[model samples]
Target: MTDRELFDTYRRDVYYLCHYMLHNAADAEDICQEVFLKAFQTDRQGVERIKPWLLRIAVNMCKSHLDRRKRGVLKELKHFLLERRRDTEAADEALERKENELETERWLRALPVKNRTVMTLRYIHELSLQEIAETLDIPPGTVKSRLNRGLRQMRRDLGKSNPNLKGAECLE
Candidate 1:
């Protein structure tokens, strides 16, 4: 495919992936541009699946950007503080929050980055396990393991507190 055609076809997908990973629209746009630029410059005649290839670039770039920000060290503390703050909300606000959220979206945000990426690619983007493995450049086995572990972690962490959070039945 021509560069413009490829870009037009997958731009939203690439942008959504970067947005999902970085949680920042500007940064996601920047990374999405870089992904397309890099893909355009590379010789892709041998690539069997262009979308997965593009996604692999996006995943790597997002991970690199996250590493540069050095927020991994603060992730645990931030998660803890956010949880504490949310727990102090009044019942009315919490009820509003629940009403505003989709059950899966709520649980997906509660997961770690690795598990979140795997789950997002698998569920939200509707990629097959092998496609996800290619997109993330991991073994299919690793993808399965993350999905499994993510399910358990999501349950153990959020299930007891919010017994009504019930959208995780398909992550297996």
Candidate 2:
């Protein structure tokens, strides 16, 4: 496929993957462009699955990006964002949105990077276990273990934070 076609077909996938991993729009956009630029430079004739290959690249890029920075600041920023009350037409809807945001942030904070990436691939991106393995270049069993461990950890973390929170139901 041409560069434009490749980009158009998978930009959202790539961007979201990066955004979810990095938790920053500007960083995700930068990484997404870098992913496509690298894609444009590489020979695609040998790549059988464009989406997975692109995602693998994006994943590696995000991991590297994460490694280069201190994570404390990002967590602080996210916590700050979650603390702010939004102005909305529907109080119930706003409450639900804020709840979801806080839940997501908690989940993200609870898991390690590897486990978080696995969870994101399985839950958010909706990739199968096998696909996650290939995208992360790990075994399928590893992917399953990561998911299980992440869910368990998240459940414990959520439970500790809120007595009424149904961690397993939300996680599963």
Candidate 3:
């Protein structure tokens, strides 16, 4: 497929992967552009599956981006921690929703890169274990192991933060 066609087909998937992986929309957009640019430059003669191949590139790019921006991410984390909630009833509901999203984001970000990537690809993207393996260039067993370990870590973290938190058991 032509570059335009490929971008059209995979843009949303690529953007979503980058967004969830990075938890930043602007960074996601930049990385999405870079992904297509890299894809356009590379020859795809032997690539058996385009989606997995593209995702693998995105994953690598996000990892690299995260590594380079470790300080910035930490700063953002601090900002999230310092942010205060509003007190109005309407704001309370909105604040609750935002808090839930922030909590989930924090949990995902706390995971190691491999574990985070595997979990995002498996749950957010809804890829099968085999598909995650292919996208991550790892064995299916590794994918399962990471998923289990990541879930365990998330559960542990949540329990420590909120003892009454429900649905954590469903992770197992």
Candidate 4:
């Protein structure tokens, strides 16, 4: 497939992955653009795959964006204390879902960046361990370890106040 065609097919998925990682739609769009731009610049010769390549680019862009964002936030005490509020209203079911999602986000925020990336790729993107390893350029064993550790941390976080939280899948 041509670069444009290949990237077009995966754009939404890539954007979702970026959005999940950055937690900001604007940053995710920027990262997605960077991913596609990098793909356009690279030599595609001897390349037997496209999705993994695009994902690798996307993941690197996400990490870089996160790093820069971290440094920027560190420089401002007032900005560091500010929180981004969710804008959506809550229905009964929506409220429950949002609560669970917020808790998951809290858990995710507590883990190391690498482990959080693994968990997002594994659970949100629904990528296989092998696919994740290839995309992240890590060994499969390392992905497994990060995933396990992230899950354990999430479970501990969820179980802190409510034992019933353990009965539901953390992602739910």
Global lDDT of each model?
0.78, 0.79, 0.79, 0.73
Alpha carbon lDDT at 109, candidate 4: 72
For model 1 the TM-score comes to 0.74
- Please count the clashing residue pairs in each candidate, in the order shown: 0, 0, 0, 0
Best-to-worst order by TM-score is 2, 1, 4, 3
> What are the RMSDs of all candidates, in order?
7.9, 5.0, 6.3, 6.6
Residue-level lDDT of model 3, residues 62-133, one tens digit each, is: 879988987234211212322345444476687776777688878988988678778777776668898899
Worst 10 residues of 2 by lDDT: 72-81
- Clashes in model 3: which pairs? none
lDDT of 1 at 49: 89
Error of 3 at 37 (Å): 2.2
lDDT of 1 by residue, 58-151 (tens): 9889889989997552121101112445778998987666654445566767787788788778766778999999988899999999999888
**Model 4 C-alpha lDDT per residue in residues 1-172, reported as the tens digit of each score:** 7876877798977887777667777888989998888888888886666777778889778778878877322110011101234345446755666666666667777888778778777776678898899999999999999999998887777677566665565435
Comparing 2 and 4 on lDDT, the stronger one:
2
The CA root-mean-square deviation of candidate 3, after full C-alpha superposition on the true structure, stands at 6.3
